[model samples]
Target: MILQLKEVNGMEEGERTALLAIAMNLVIFGIKYVSASATGSIALKAEAFHTLADFVASLTVFTGLKIAKRKTKSFPYGLYKIENLMSVIISLVILYTGYEIILDVINTDLTELRNSGFAIFSLLIATFLTFWFSNYERKIGHKINSPILLADSSHIRIDVLSNLIVLLVVVASLFGFHFDKIAALIVVIFIVKTGIQILMDGIRVLLDASVDYETLSKVEKIILDTPQIIKLKTLTGRNSGRYKFIEADIVLKTHNLDRAHFIAERVERITKEEIKNIDQVQIHYEPLQKEEIIYVLPLTEDKTSISPHFGEAPCFMLVTFKSGTETASKTEILTNPYANIQKGKGILAAELIVKNMVDFVLVKNGFESKGPHYVFSDANIELV
Candidate 1:
């Protein structure tokens, strides 16, 4: 289907973005590291470590995607949760780096920082690359709906802002204004905030928290709008990394067991069509309980004559009995779709009757019983 192809394309795009992010993060890290060592600016050093954290986050995204795509039959649900687990690991790494940066600010001698024009050039480069890359990766992340890429993008966004503050510190030192440690402390706060945010999101996915309320509402609306589904009993949905899965139970206002199944199938199809991100949908249906005896009769067009043939009949007349007495009746002259088929007519007709939820089939006296008779017998459809 076109939809399936689009999904694959989106996934490929996410992978490509992750690779790009790793390269950019590494470049930023190297540039910042050089400046930090040359001038001994605490902010520059913290920014270097933040870039390193971003690099690791990018690697985590790549590894998670590779593992998630290798799902096997033993794990039919796939390995999507691996992405969330990797996110958690990435967040903890960032948190540790953040604490280190905070401690460095608290313990290091701030008065020893050396002012240098070359450090400003390096910081400028770091700032521009991080700001541009963050926006680029964020656009890609949204395009593919990838949580890993989005998480990594968030990390890079903080990198851009922190790099700006580091640049300011370098500029201020050149103007006889020295508050490098204070600026570095500001960067640490931003880094820690981003880490906590990513950590909470990862933990939520690992715990199987329910999806957003808007998505849940949309799901409920889709099921309720299905024609034969009279009522929805229950609905539960959860996220798996960037994807979603839903399980539902519904009540159908139909006495026929076969029609109930077909309705449920329609609901599942419609739900998937309406919502593209849902990777799995499980639907359970119950038929309406009513005291009725239903019978199906093969008839000629206009209901004027009996058709000895079952599969070739132009239409069928449905009759219903209640309390062992006639309650309601209807005759439908629907086209027999299998009439022109050369083979499998009997099976198709049997399936049609089952879909109608017929209890009995009235046949003309001399009707043959090779194909349809056997089919009806297997389905417990009495022929008389």
Candidate 2:
């Protein structure tokens, strides 16, 4: 099952990144707030609020990590959508703060942060730290394939750009140009743009849109390279947190229904192996047009059980359904190769049956799942 796919320590790594961001934001917040107070600069004050927003955004990402991994009775699928929800929350905060900065700048008396050496020095240090932190988180985000981490890092980059704008306000003030209001407006505009991008990213995931084009194309290529696939009917994917969920419909080249199912299983396994962070994949398949085939069964030594246990059966009994009826025309017995497998008896039995092109295996207890059932179903074989 694709749901079984996992990356070791992915969540741990994401939480570490988010926590680091939180610490960075706090450090920058104190530095910039002091800088804003000393210089009487509206632009620097806006940067302080921007850092505060970063702090909140970091908390949201950390919370998303916690919720994404948890599944409860009321939330059996886990809380992965919390990532999108957190992103939207972060975006709105950024947007609202940016608007506040714009109005504050437009109304404030235009002046350069005069003789504010400590303020400029502090802003520079915060800028360099924000830049480094954003870069670090971005690298880790890509490594873990964490959308929330990536989005949060982008949000931090907005801080870096805002710092640069504040520096521009300082330079313009020295020249008596007094472009502080205009420079702060530019920084707010950049913040709003980053917020919009973050919002779109979250909305796309919330809407269950198809996954990234590159990944979707990779999945398509892998399926086409599979040996027995006749036609790819549909290949679709979506995301929740760091994981991708895929569903595909395929047609098999073989006329035998059993053969078609075998192909679907192969596709599922290979795709999951090649693609990291795929938490689930469901395959719907069809066989190429073909003639009707035999009805297969398992039998005991005495051939007395129409309901013989497949694991203990000594031989297989093949029969044909009477035309347009549930009745069998006759029974023919063949040796069972997997009656005494040391391990994986069901799997070995299923493989043997599929190789012989058997259509069905009947069992009194219904069917064993995973190994044998997965095998049988993959080959379009059935148990009754």
Candidate 3:
């Protein structure tokens, strides 16, 4: 079930942070608007409008988080893109806030500041609150990997810087100098810069851009490390909101349909375990086609005679031949490195054979209920 606004304790971390930002912005907007009216400072009025924009942006983020959780019949994949859409809207709001500041700087006449002490004190309080909340919100945004929250946090950071500039102007007015218009123009630069960054990030996700290269590399390593996978045909990942969707095509060593499916499931499970925020993992697997067959036989110390004991054998002989023909095309003898091991010798020997890509094991007797038997069985290697 989706979390509702009424359930405060059960709400997602992103929703909680967004709601906090809305409340904080509202309070700051009131303080700035009061200070602007009392002092008649243009920069203070511009900051008041910017704080109001922040309030609207935070509301948009909260709404997006709520809607993104719903999975309708038309949107089987969920409305994850709503978060990115909200980010775009927030960016536009920030940009418009900057434009308004620029207009105020150009059109408003220079007015002597009144109640300078009150304006400076109020701006200091607003700046301190903005700085604290922006940092706190950003920490939660990264922890939950929420795109809208991160975008909103960045917008709040711009407020912190702008408030500081306006405070400096208010203090300078006490010295018979007024640079309120110049300070507001500087604040606009920061606002525009932040807006563009958020806009680009939102657009990329909305366009179905691939996930970062580092994440893709980590996934590739995980897939390649699986012993049953013969080759990885394709691997691709993309981001929807803050979650990742991964798809891969692989070739397995086993020809059995059930074994192929089992290997695919194992790969999917491991991939999800190793990666964070994975929404879905789709793995398409096929069996490897055999053009040649390899056989491994346990050998005695002399290397010429077959050993009846599979685990205690000192060496192993590998013979390779075309699938249809009986005559061997290549033969090699390999030392059994695990022959002297006191424990798990049979299992280690079986793993060595699997690593050599042996299709069959030639043995003198049955090895039922043995560790080696299960190992070879899992690899789909036949006993002859």
What are the per-residue Cα lDDT tens digits for candidate 1 across 1-384?
Answer: 876788788888888888988898898889888888989888788888878888888888988877875669998898888888988888888788889888888888876457478888887888888888888888987777777777888888887788778788888888789888898788878878888998999999999999899888988998865545657889999989778999998877665778677767777777778876778889888876657777887787667777777777767787777745765645444567886688877668866776665678887853455777666654456788
Deviating ranges (above 4 Å) for candidate 2: 1-8, 253-262, 291-384
The candidate, 1 or 3, that scores higher on lDDT is: 3
Residue pairs clashing in model 3 are: none
For 304-373, candidate 2 gives per-residue lDDT tens digits of: 7753467667887778765467777667787877778677777777777776556657776766656878
Q: Extract clashing residue pairs from model 1.
A: none
Which numbered prediction scores highest in lDDT against the true structure? 3
- How many collisions between residues are there in candidate 3? 0
Query: Residue 299 of candidate 2: its Cα lDDT?
Result: 72
Model 3 Cα lDDT, one tens digit per residue, 1-384: 122232223237778888899999999999999999999999999999999999999999999999987789999988888999999999999999999999998899999999999998898899999999999988887777788888999999998888888988988999988999999999999999999999999999999999999888888898887777778999998888877899999988877788788888887787777776677889998888988999999999998778988988999999999989999999999899998989999899988888898999999877998999988887778898
Report the Cα lDDT for candidate 1: 0.80
Q: Give RMSD to native, each candidate.
A: 8.5, 10.4, 3.2
Models ranked on TM-score? 3, 1, 2
| Residue 96 shift from truth in candidate 2, angstroms | 0.8
